[model samples]
Target: MKSLFLFFFLAVSAAIYAQSASTAIKPKPSYCNEPPEAYDSRKNASAVKPAALPKFNSKPVMEYRVQVAILRKTDPTKYPFHRSLVARYQPCEEVWIVESKQSFRNRQDAEKLRAELAKMGYGGAYITTLVGYE
Candidate 1:
């Protein structure tokens, strides 16, 4: 019975020693390849800087609204139709957009209005889509 207790104690001591010695925590490496960069983080220190992207001064685009219009012909200054709108500026200064009361949310409705205006003797009538800025 004494030898049996001694054997069990030795087996438990070996197991406890094996577990503590095998499971050692380690610190992660600073880089993967090449030398580290001073400006970059540890995870991306060895990464290469990409090329610069093209700078564009473009305005943000929103949902487009379809507009139907006809140029004023009677005095060129006065609206041909009482309900039609007039452009505020010339092309040299700013974009001249004359949106009439016949603006539509969809293309199909705008095309229908253009055809109706054409049949009504407004031969110069046309459809143009306008963004938020216009």
Candidate 2:
């Protein structure tokens, strides 16, 4: 009787241990079993499109000469001084005096120079593009 009881107890323990081990080992799904429809090429193509160029005005381009100046103040009191200086220096017929809140003498010369000045420490300089009418 003792031997039979021992044998049954060992058999139950082995069955429980085998069930726990199998539960710990998860089975991975086989790729071959997946449906062919899951790998669709149409889905990727629909997400992308060719970029378009922006439209611009085709009007005649006018070029203007520019002069850069550093004014002492913004009030009209400063205008006469600027006007006098501009009249004295007098840029060619195409050039005009442009007033700005900030001082950037070299940058006001051209668009590229203005952009470069903005990148450097002179972002406050007001930009004026001159277009010669005459």
Candidate 3:
């Protein structure tokens, strides 16, 4: 009798679960419903003109700096010009460039530093212009 009651209880539970599942609302998957005019690029191309390139201020600004050395490797601690000294790596040239930390407004100031550096071991030191930090 218990076994029959157990079977009937399972049958009723399954029917109730099935009826609830069928009545439950299911969400439908959304799709891109774009119009045919938007999909047609060629027809839209005539309506949309190409954007013009932005204009930049072409005025050139010049600054001078005394270049101490250009080497594959450099030790900042060993550099003689400890005051206001900076080193930058040139990836294209594959070299480490050592220069003055600050730019001199006048070429004469840069030349003076180059002359002093030449007196030291850095004989190849020269005055170089940094064109827009190039």
Candidate 4:
């Protein structure tokens, strides 16, 4: 009976040791499953062709004149008041206006208007040129 008990105890201890060993030595998955095409190097290397350049047509480029407002208003409330004053100078009330002209056209017209407005000594009145549209 003593030998039998000893044999049963050894068997149970061996089984418990195996269970703990298996838990400690867990299997991990492999990280190399992705194919080469999934990488940037392979994708870029496969497309070695250069992109096509765009073509342009020759035509008389239409230009536009723009009147820019260059004055900075220190007081926000004065914006409406300044606008009203500018409207007095421009009968059309176009505190802003655009005119279409040729690309090589002289900017004298726009500059003269800006100079005249500057002479009036408005705090927020100035002009600039811009590309015109049809």
Query: lDDT of each model, Cα atoms only?
Result: 0.54, 0.45, 0.70, 0.44
RMSD of 4: 28.2
Q: Pairing residues by index, what is the TM-score of model 4? A: 0.28
Q: Candidates 1 and 2: which is better by lDDT?
A: 1
Give residue 83's lDDT in candidate 3 (0 to 100).
62
Q: lDDT at 131 for candidate 3?
A: 64
- Tell me the spans in candidate 3 whose CA falls farther than 4 Å from its real position: 1-50, 73-81
Residue-level lDDT tens digits of model 2 in 84-132: 1232211222223443323333433455555554565445544554443
- TM-score of predicted model 2? 0.22
Worst 10 residues of 4 by lDDT: 85-94
What value does the lDDT take at residue 2 in candidate 2? 95
Model 1 clash pairs are none
User: Looking at candidate 2, what is the lDDT of residue 86?
Assistant: 39
Order the candidate numbers by lDDT, best to worst: 3, 1, 2, 4
- Model 4, span 62-127: residue lDDT tens: 332423342321222334532323311222221322222222246675455446556655424344
Backbone Cα, N, C clashes tallied per candidate = 0, 0, 0, 5
Off by over 4 Å in 2: 1-61, 64-70, 73-109
Best by TM-score: 3
lDDT of model 1 at position 117:
65
User: If candidate 3 were superposed on the true structure by all CA atoms, what would the RMSD be?
Assistant: 23.2
Model 4 local distance difference test score = 0.44
Q: List the residue pairs that clash in candidate 3.
A: none
